[model samples]
Target: MTELQDTGLRRRADDAAPSITDLIDEETVQSIAQEAWSALVGEDEFLVPLPGDLPEDAVSSWVDVRGPWNGTVVITTGRSTAEQLSRELLKEHAPPVLDEEDIEDGLGELANVVGGNVKAVLPGPSALGLPVVGDAPVAGPDTCRVDLLWRGQSLTISVQGTAGALLDQ
Candidate 1:
């Protein structure tokens, strides 16, 4: 695990995308189910120390953002949360319950939404890969993260770049 500052990702005057810190703060950092907070939590409250890591569970998803520089955005959830969310996401599709397959899709979709939005900020020339299931750690190169809290749960937003690029650019 490394901090972005250590990687020293400086933006040249000609660069279009903002620095990793700025990118995370302005784009990826957000409350999970913010719109539904009121309905679920009954007060539309934002989680404290919000913006935490989104851990991997039985069901989780992610999206990829690419451009002149390559990086990734990951979203994960706890296994229990996956089961609960799976019920909602697959109840109808499976006649009142979600199987492993349904949960997988839900996980992927969550990652996709978050990942896609982030990738859009970068130049269109790059490519973002599909989301996977596992507790992958993101901490290397130019990376920034926001820890989010929702009813005691944490959703981590990790952005890693400089993963592979100009070794000394």
Candidate 2:
């Protein structure tokens, strides 16, 4: 008869997953956003910490991270603000008539930059998914969200875990 002894390498199904707070905080997120804005949006653009209510027509863009920590980095702002950002991103190349595709592309790029930075602070060897624009994903229990204002416009960034894993909370 073969004897088996426990090596304690296995993890429980509900093993506590690492939270965003454990890896990074809102200040780091804001710093990353600021850098992205300065480089991509404009040289003088800055993000303020003052919180404001998001408009009913708010739009969001996000990128998913899969690794030791799994979640999404989402950026949300009003539609008009998105348009303004898109214009800034395109700068002199912006068309007179801003289009939906332009706004999404700009927002997606912002999310990618911020998401890539956020991923860097996490456990590492993580893969970032292509950006997606739409409603923000449902926040998990360990989600870490940050609110910011840009040119008096309300905007937010969130890092949220998987929905199924949220139930473990």
Query: Which candidate's lDDT is highest?
Result: 2
How high is the CA lDDT of each candidate model?
0.54, 0.82
Residues 56-166, model 1: lDDT tens digits: 442335555656656666655677665555455444554565676766666666666566656554533556777766666353453655566656777555666664332
Model 1 accuracy (lDDT, Cα) = 0.54
Candidate 1, residue 151: Cα displacement in angstroms equals 3.6
lDDT of 1 at 74: 62
Question: Candidate 2 — what's its lDDT?
Answer: 0.82
Clashing pairs in 2: none
The alpha-carbon deviation from the true structure for residue 69 of candidate 2, after best TM-score superposition, in angstroms, is 0.2
Model 1 segments more than 4 A misplaced: 1-18, 26-28, 31-60, 90-94, 137-142, 163-169
Q: What is the lDDT of residue 95 in candidate 1?
A: 53
